[model samples]
Each structure stands twice: as structure tokens, then as C-alpha cells.
Target: MPNLELLAPLAAALLAAGLFAGLLAGLLGVGGGIIMVPVLYYVFGLLGVDEAVRMHMSVGTSLAAMIPTSIRSALAHRKKGAVDEVMFRRWLPGIALGVLAGVLTAAFVKGPVLMTVFAVFALLVAVYMAFGKDSWRVASELPGRLGQTIMAFLIAAVSVMMGIGGGTFTVPTLTLFGYPIHKAVGTAAAIGVLIAIPGAIGFILGGLGEPGRPWGSLGFANVVGVLALIPTTLLAAPWGVALAHRLERRWLRLAFAFFLAATGIKMALSLLGA
Candidate 1:
């Protein structure tokens, strides 16, 4: 077990991160998994866990927390006339299988490599979302089935590599393709559940099979970390939704872009040790 003092800061970080993630979700209509994954990785690294297993715990724990958070956000969005159920249904199968594949693959990758990959993705996405043409379009031109399937596959592949829930990629992709931003956000939130449920299970099963690793971890997921994160995120998620309902979305997108840039820079620096 980690020292109580260590756990305190971690607990505080989780709470703050949850609230922050909620605000980002509600305000930007994002799934919050993008921010949560990197934060988990940073916090876990600070706790002195073995580098090799850090990415697993970070990705798994983020998915665990996201299960409840996404549900809360999705419901909130559904209430507001966002979240396209039709799109969600179409994407389920691809999302389900892809997430499982990502988690299983992560169980075997090296930590530095994972971090570097995450950094690269974050850096690219941040740049694109902040400056890309499709950053916030009101209409998409892609066929519904093809777009959802492609996104599901992309989300699963990226989540495993970067510890995200595919929101950063999904929301923008959907919006660019013609879905309303709010609908895209809500749909993205629903996808988090698909990614989290299977991913969390895979982490647990994988962790159990690893012979020697840091104590207090269940597979690649840390029991301690998951337990610490759940409540605060659940509570904050709805609050974020309420806030989202109140804010002007253009400003919110700007805020979301800024947050992504900050996270990307931090992750890049961590990988480069600068």
C-alpha cells in the first residue's frame, strides 16, 4: 500500500481532476477521458510505480472512472436534446471489439513507448483541434454507418495507446462530418462506456495474470486509484453538465483547446524529461 501521506495528495489530485474533467465535459461536451488519462499517467508516475506498468494503470483507471462519469454526462446531454442514440447503436460493435483489442495490446507495451505515443497523438490532436478546418463544423458529409464505424475503430485504437476515451478525436470527427457539436459530445460520452466496460475488465484480467508487480494493483488497473476516483467524478460529472448548459459554446471550445494544449505539452515534457 502507498503511504497515507502519498494517498492524500493523490486523492486531492483525483478530486480536482474529476471536477476539472467534469467542467471540461460539460462545457466542451467532451467525454473527459482525454484529460483524465494523461492526468492519471502523471499522478501514477509521481507515485513511484514501475514505469513499464504505469500506462496500463493509467489507461485502466481512467476507463474505470469514466464509466460513471460518462453515464452521468450522457444522461445530462440526452436531457438537453443532444446525444444521438441512433448513432450510438450503429457504432457499438466496432467500439466494443476495438476497446478490448487496445487494452489487451497495452498490457504488453513498454511504458516509455506508450507515453511517447500518447504524447505524439496529443500533440497532433491539440494542433488540429485548435487550428484545423473541421474543428467545429455544424454539418458532416460522411455516411452515418461508415463514419461511426471508422470512429469506433479509431477511438479503440487510440484509447489503448494514449489512455483516452476517444472524445478528443470523436467529438471533432463527428462535428466535422456534420453532427452538431453537442450531439457529437453526447455520442462521444456514450462511447466512453463501451470503451471503459470492456477495457476495465481486460485490465483486471490482465493484472491478475501478471506474477510480480507493484502491490495494490488489480491487473494493470490500480484498485486504490479506481476506488479513490469514482465518487468525486460521479458527483462532478452532473455539475459539469449543468455548467455546460449555461456556457456559450464558442468560448467553451476555446477552453477545451487550451486544456488539450497544456496537457499535450506536459506529457511531451515528461517523455523528454525536460
Candidate 2:
């Protein structure tokens, strides 16, 4: 017997967030976890959920909501021949295992510790996106297949722990290894599916026996939020992928930089009581 009126505002928030998330996902190959995570943190705060559960819920919910959006966007990119299936096959195993480890770590970590880690990581990503080099193409690539495999492992591990789909690091890493921006983003989009599937499952498993969860939650995944968002995201993601094809490499890099900076500031502020 919840008040339907209150759900109106929550529904609106979810829709708006999902719309933006879809755009970001399609355009930049990001999973929108960075954006969704902080927003969910604040929203859950208002709902009086414990801070301990807030981050887990936010991360899990974002991963769940990202599934359809990523799928739609990936398909759009695939249609354009932008996705590198070979790269995806190389990275899948690592991303899957990494995401599981990440979810388990998040579930076990103390709340304050997790928040602090998240804040630091956010700041670093923002700074990297903002001031770091933007060559947009890596030449004289890293050694052999072995090097690439190691890189995949590291990227997956970090992405899972942070609840990101690995784009924040993946695109730049690829660029540094001689890949162009468009290919990097397209490949990253495809990799998102690999990350989300297992990450979502991990979240569900980790939260299954947790206590005092709100109704309408599926483990840590918020069913209400997911249902409200998936449709909007599915509809918007294709448009975003189309738009991504129109943007030049320079513009795309700048846009992603701005996004990372904004996400970082928002998270840092919340953590700092600002």
C-alpha cells in the first residue's frame, strides 16, 4: 500500500536518468554506471535506506538497468560494423571473472571504505579524462597477444570493482595501444555486454540474503527502477548510436571528457558532504 503519488516523482527521475544514460551509453560506449550510481546514492539517501546498503543498491541497480541499453546500443554499432568481435572474444573471459570478483568485494567491503575508494577513483578518472593525453590513436602497439591478454585482465578487474563497464579505462587504453577512437568506442560498447551480464548476476547473488531490503527490489537490483528505465533506455540507445556515428573523434573525446568531469565532481561532492 505505497502512496502512488510519491511514485510519480520517483518514476520521473528514473525516466530522465534512463534517457540520459541511454544517450551516454550509445555515444561513448559507457555503461552509465558512473552517472546512475551517484544519482541512486542520493535518491536512496532521501528514501532513508541505510548508507551501508546505498552504494551496493546503486551499483547493482545501475548494472541491471544498463543491460537493455547496452544491448540496443551494441546492436546498433554492430549494424554499422563498428564492433570488433575478435576483440570481444579476447576480452570476454576476463571481464566475466573480473566482474564477479568486483561484486563480491563490494558486497563485503565496509560502506565508508567503499565510498572512499569510489571517491578517489572517480577523481582519478575525471582528471584522466580532463587533462590526460588525447592522441585518439595509438601507434607502435604493445608487444603481442600476451600483452593484450594481460591488459584485458587488469581492465576487467578494475572495471568490475568500480561497477563501470570498463569504458572509462578501456577506450583510452586501446587508444594508447594504437586503436582509433571510433574502433575503441565500438569495441568498448560490445565489451559492455560481457561486463554487465556477469556483473548483474553477481549483484543479484551477493544481495540475495541481505537483510531489510526494500520491497520491489530484486536482490540489489531495484525492480521498480529497472522497469521504469529499461523501456526508455531501449528506445533512446539507438538514436544515441546513430549520433555517435556522426561525431568526429575530437568531438567525441571532448564530450566524454566533460562527462567524466561532471560525474567525478558530483560524486566527490556527495562524498565530501558538499
Candidate 3:
């Protein structure tokens, strides 16, 4: 039997993380997986989980947790007609291929290296979110098929390694290409569902039979973590969607940028032993 006593604290922390993750999913199209990875990693460490697989477990479990939240957020956004169907279709094939590659990358890359990359990337995106003008555009339209495939691949792959749902990359990339922020956020929410599904499956397969995982883990995903996070995340996500619709686009972007900057800085500081 699992030890409920030891699990209580982890459950508490997971619930809190879920709340934030859900809100961000709706508000900024981020699946909250980015934040959840670090939280799960720390709590798992305190639980005596093995260091070798701790990051893997964190990434996998976070991907699993994101499934429901992203779905919920997507549905809420769709109801408001914020989702851009044309862009979603154009982006789907590449997103699929990229998700597969990303899952594979996560299997081989070292955790610290991935974290550093994530931190640098987040900071860069944050800068754009904070200051990029509406007129800024790489082109008058999104790239042609080949270029889009590569960009989509990179977005999905990087997001998987970082335990995110690809929104962190997608939203800014879309906005940079002249898509409206609201449309970018909503479309990204739907795309997150795709990223999380395959990413979760890949992690589960990758971690099969691996030792030193937490109790109740199926591969790297912990049943307790998924369960504890889901309810609150489902509850909070709709609230965030409503609020995001109410807020001005500029304010929403600024708030999201601030949050990303803080998360990235905190991760970078961890590398310096801070």
C-alpha cells in the first residue's frame, strides 16, 4: 500500500501548482507545465527520489497533468471564438512531427542542460512580450511549408524537453508574425493539448522499468500527482479564461511576460547554486 502520510505534503504542493498552471493555461495559453516541472522536481527530491531520473519524472508527470488543463482551457477559449482555426490547421502537421522529436530529445539530454536552455529561451521570449510592437513582423505572413515545419518542430521539441505545452514558444512566435495576441493565446491552448498528449506518452514509454521512481508512478508519471492536480486545475482554468477575455491585450502580455521572466530567472539562479 502507498504511504498516505508521506504523500500528503506532495499532494498539497501539487494542488497549489495545479491552480497556477490552470490559470496560466487560460490566461496566456501556457500549460503551466513549465512551472510544474521545477515544483515536482524539488518535492520529489525531498521525498528521496533518485537524482538520475528525478527530472525525467518531473517532465513526464507534468506532461500528464497538462492534458486535462490544456483541454479545458482550449474548450473555454473556443467558446469565446478566440481560437484561430486556419492557423491551427496549418500548424497541426508540424506540431505532430515536432512533438515526437521533442519527446525523443528529452530522453537523451541531461537535465541541467535542458534547464539552462529553457531559462535562456524563456528570458528571450519575455523580452519580446514586454517590448515588441504590433507592427513588428518577420514577414507579412507566416512562413511557407518548409520553414513552418522546422519552426513547429523546434517549438514542440523544446517544449517537451522543458515540460511545457509549447505555448511559451507559440504565443510569441504567432504574435511576432502579426497574429493578434488573443488569437495566438487561444490557438496555443489548443496546440498544447496536442503537445501534452504525445509528450506524456513518450515519457511513459521512455521510463518503463526505470528504477527509483516515486510510488504509484506509471513509468515516470505519478498517479497521485496527476490526480491531485487535475481537479483544481480544471476548476481554476475557466476562471482564467474569463479573466483573460476581460483584460486588455497589452496588460495580458505584460503580466505573462513578468511571470515568464520571474520563472526563467529563478531557474537560472538555481544553476548558480543560489
Return the top candidate by TM-score.
Answer: 3
| Candidate 1 C-alpha lDDT tens digits along 57-153 | 7877777777777778778888887778887888888787787678767777777777777777877777775676545565547566776687688
The order of the candidates by lDDT, greatest first, is 3, 2, 1
**Candidate that scores best on lDDT:** 3
- Model 3: lDDT equals 0.84
From the highest TM-score down, the ranking of the candidates is 3, 2, 1
Residue-level lDDT of model 2, residues 1-274, one tens digit each, is: 3457777787789788878778778877776766677777767776667777777787778888888777777788888888888878877666766776677777788656556666677777766666666564456575466667777777766666566677767877887877766788788888887777788888888888687565688888888778877877787788778887786545655665676567667667766789
lDDT of 3 by residue, 1-274 (tens): 5567977877898899889888878887888887788788878877888877888888899999999999999998999899988778887888898888888787787667767877888788778879977677876677888887788888988898888999888887887787887888899999999899989999999889988898889987887788988888888899889887787668767876797799789879977889
Stretches of candidate 2 exceeding 4 Å from the true structure: 1-3, 136-139, 248-274
Off by over 4 Å in 1: 132-140, 209-213, 250-252, 272-274
lDDT of each: 0.72, 0.74, 0.84
Candidate 1 weakest lDDT stretch, 10 residues: 133-142
Off by over 4 Å in 3: 1-6, 129-135, 249-266, 269-274
Model 2: colliding residue pairs: 138-178
TM-score of 3: 0.89
